[model samples]
Target: MKTPFALAAMTALLLPAALPARSAADPVFTAAAMRAHVEFLADDLLQGRDTGSEGHEIAARYVASQFDGLGLKPAGDAGGWLQRIAFQQTERTNIPAVLTLTGPAGDKSWTHGTDVIVGLNPDEPKVDLSAPLVFVGYGIENARMGLNDYAGLDVKGKIVVTLRGYPKGLPSEEGAHLSATKAKVAEAHGAVGMLSVATLQSMKARPWARMLTFANEPDFTWVDTDGQAHVDAPGIRAAASVNEPVVAALFAGAPQSIAAIRKQADKPGGKPRGFALKGSARIQVESVGKRVASPNVVGILPGSDPVLQREYVVLSAHLDHIGISEAKPDDKPDTDRINNGALDNAAGIATLLEVARAMALSPEKPRRSIIFLASTGEEKGLLGADYFARHPAVPVRQIVGNVDLDMPLLLYPFTDVIAFGANHSTLGPIVANAVAPMTIKLSPDPMPQEGIFVRSDHYMFVKQGVPAVFLATGFANGGEKAWGDFLGGAYHHPGDDMNQKIDWNAGARFAEANYRITRALADSDAAPLWYQADFFGDTFAPNAKKAAH
Candidate 1:
């Protein structure tokens, strides 16, 4: 609610009035420095820095070296930089997935490639499904929208095939059936299996967005399911309704056409419905599973005040990228094979390094400990962070705030930084107040649709009731359109390489700005907190909402 100037004035009141200004000659962050780090991390030699790979291992060492050079103390478990994790990487292959339909005539078996393709469910061994396939409309259940696609049928142990995306154009609050939340709905309905059809557009463009899930890797989680989760088989592929002819043939005499089914799913009063298709399926998969290890590099700077030093302020950045993709049908060059991830997170990690260096050299350490956390497996699902929060090096209760940096370079030079999940917590004010002096305007989270808040490693901390923030540059800020162009084209693609053109000076200034804000929090007496309105604010105090006035 306060102006940036008012916040700066308050900050000035907290610190010495005569604090000396940083010298112009002081080394600032530069793109050259960031590019230098990216060169190796995103280099062809790193082989896309795949988790548990030798290349990612090299990257870990490099980041650790930077932390070491900054004189940061090892703050990991057992006082080691690496907190080792275990995982299994599985690759399935050569399994028979057959389907057959028995009608008034005889039984006709469906071929694997033509009728359907099978994938394993996280549950291992084998998952054999022979139940009738039900078209559960869009599989949406919304009270407000009056849409319930699963109202009648008992789908337990059955495979529910549905479409992707929400209704074409409807007020979101009206409960237009959303395809995004179907996985949870499927699980809740006791449905053992789910098959999501590509959107009509995606079906027309590409058959399906073929997914390559990681097997449990030593460094990251391969299977993206709850450990307690059960799958009838090791894996399952919910088949896609890609080809129109395929849909037509499958639903030959069904109650509703595929389009009509999707339409009904979008309307109010859409209830659990069923249709019969004359087809049977057989599924099989053989996979290669391996074990590997990855690390979340951490370095700590203890605070000046003994009592407050026990409390911690964490600064984090993910250090991994989307390693390599399975070779696609349209082959390009060797260079196109790797995803450099220069802007996605290499820039973020580089900025964190600079922030740590600056903070370590500050005139005085703040009241709380400052932790430099280089998180791994962010590309996967923030696995390193999840492990860290569960098995903390320090007490989770002692962590006051977590400031996470994702992609900060591409959108710099804007009027302000986009502070995501601001409405969710009290830390928003602290972040806003801290960065005021840098003329860095902090505003509410911009791209909530992207679920940016939930997507980052910071969410792991937030879930634990630790106040957290994820900072990114914004296109809405006063930078060139190229900034947005860069963010869009190279976010997670192979073309995100470090070349000649980049604004290194702006990056340096941005790093400096982040350093100052971190210092402010580190030195402050009051701990950062989540506002009562935040979804995770109640984590620390289960009754926080009820207690709110």
Candidate 2:
């Protein structure tokens, strides 16, 4: 394959030059200014701004400097612009060479990488357990939905085996979020451990070899004020994802064969019934972890109105990337190995900084204070944002709204934008009004299957009852091809550097739109409220007030 630079250079030459010309370049949010920031943040020296790495700290400091230059007040930890957060990094040190299953027929063994892929627990460094198995269809427990996979089964002190993914009929947004909580459901159901058997569908989507590669990657979780890792339910001792062969072995002599369960799950609206498996699986995992600290650079532009000043409107963008490349070795030594994350988030941070500059320079200040937050560890499961939500710099209740900037595709002159979670709250109209001046259409999510609503830093604040929206350039005017090409070629790879066909004007417009949104939220008579009966709002803030649609 050609080098990333070579490919990007070629793509740049193919891009059309029919973009609309700016009437008068905005002083605050200019393409030149945007380019300057992106050039530095996505520079080769920063290495990819991985969480808790020196590269990330340097990136955090750069954002802090930008915040400082904007004359904003420090809104992070204790009078400083950077919120130093502690994290616990976990990596599997050892895995059992051969995992064995004991059944009524005989003992069967399979090696680790071939039949199963297991993850290490941060809370438990060393764990060895053998317990009776219970196959609980999807292992979901949502009392609100009246769906409890553990209803009839008594899985106490047993290893619960569950099929991967949630029920197929649910909406993609909710389905994705629900699938993420299955592990916690097992823990809540008093299971000693959880094993998820890969479905035929899941394997086809993501092959077993890919699963094995990611299984060895390090896992990180923020350390709370109580010195506890804020990820994974503590009740479960070990967890593993197994292939079809291993799953068949566990289901031997059961009421339903593995094939039957697979077929039932494949059928529309067919819920697989749970039953106790006539086998006991044994698992052992040894993990090593250490405490490290990263910074979430934050600053505030205080409001003029005393009453509204007490309330806050937050503007956030993640400052970290996927770190370095993990590509295979080849004879081509000229291949660029650093994942620069130019569009993945360096561009987003730059957009946020420009917005801060614009907001700070406005003679007419906002009624409510606006916090400019450049978060760390966003690529690592939104850890920094989650930490800030649980342990906030300001009063959590006083924070009114959040606008998170994350990976806005700045390649094309986007005529539309996708505001994720816009429909869920009053922020919808606000976002629409904010972008209307530029004649930019507020487009619906074209790729809801990506589950972007719950995947970004803003979702953490939403979980804390803050009405939030994530903005991105929509798939319009050849944006679909750009997005497809970038995601396939440059995303998270060495190719996401400053050499790509980055439209700086689009970056500026994105910043301008966000600045308007933040200002409007800050100056609004009332804070953004959840639409009545919204899932996230109802789940996170049950008793909070809601807005009529």
Best candidate (score: lDDT):
2
Q: Provide the overall lDDT of each model, using Cα atoms, as 2-decimal numbers.
A: 0.65, 0.85
- lDDT (tens digit, per residue) of candidate 1 on 1-549: 657998898888978656766665344566677667767777878777776777778888898888888788997657777766654554455555444443334455544445454443443534455655666767777654566778876776666766654454433312221444576676677665565554453454344323312221222253322433222232233433323434555565666767766556456434426553454333343344555667788899888897999999989988878787777777866537678777777878888988887777766656789888888777766877877876677888888788899877654456577666655666677778877877778876554334567678887787687777788775555554755577557657787777625566667776876786787788777776556443357534454322121
TM-score of 2: 0.92
Q: lDDT tens digits, residues 106-167, model 2?
A: 88877667788776789888877899999999888777766688889989999998888766
Query: Candidate 1 at 319: error in angstroms?
Result: 1.1
Query: Backbone clashes in each candidate structure, one number apiece?
Result: 37, 0
For model 2, the stretches where C-alpha displacement exceeds 4 angstroms are 1-28, 94-98
Which pairs in model 2 have colliding backbones?
A: none
